[model samples]
Target: MDIWKNIIIDKHFWAFYYYCKRLGDKIWFQKLDDNRANLYLIKNGK
Candidate 1:
């Protein structure tokens, strides 16, 4: 879970989070394997 915690606390993540918030996207980061992550952008409500 430390890896996940690291991701949440990373500065770059907060930047992206606010960017998406401004654009109205519900952002998510999904881990794929051990070295990569997939970013998902979803519109509000669904």
Candidate 2:
């Protein structure tokens, strides 16, 4: 959970978030942002 929060708060994440937002890709952006929720899965290589 802490790692997930860290990822979401990362500067690169926000940069990508805004880029997708500016491109009118709310759904895609949301999906990408949602990836931050799966940090444990990622860290564990699941």
Candidate 3:
């Protein structure tokens, strides 16, 4: 399990999003407020 905090940029967000998607990993986005969010990438079996 890996987590990223404060992913507020579009490019950074999409980069992580696509990387996880291509790897077939589970990705989660949690909005902390109006201008902040967290990104979670969960690898299978780990």
Candidate 3, residue 1: Cα displacement in angstroms equals 22
lDDT of 2 by residue, 1-46 (tens): 3545555466766676566556653233333455453322222111
Candidate 1 ranges with C-alpha deviation above 4 Å: 1-7, 27-34, 40-46
lDDT of 1 at 15: 67
lDDT (CA) per prediction:
0.54, 0.46, 0.55
Query: Clashes in model 3: which pairs?
Result: none
The residue ranges of model 3 lying beyond 4 angstroms of the native Cα positions read 1-9, 28-37, 40-46
What is candidate 3's CA lDDT for residue 9? Answer: 52
RMSD of each: 5.8, 11.0, 7.9
Top of the candidates by TM-score: 1
lDDT of 1 by residue, 1-46 (tens): 3344444455666666666677775656443435677654434455
TM values, all candidates? 0.43, 0.39, 0.38
List runs of model 2 lying over 4 Å from the truth. 1-7, 29-46
For candidate 2, the TM-score is: 0.39
**Candidate 3 — worst ten consecutive residues by lDDT sum?**
1-10
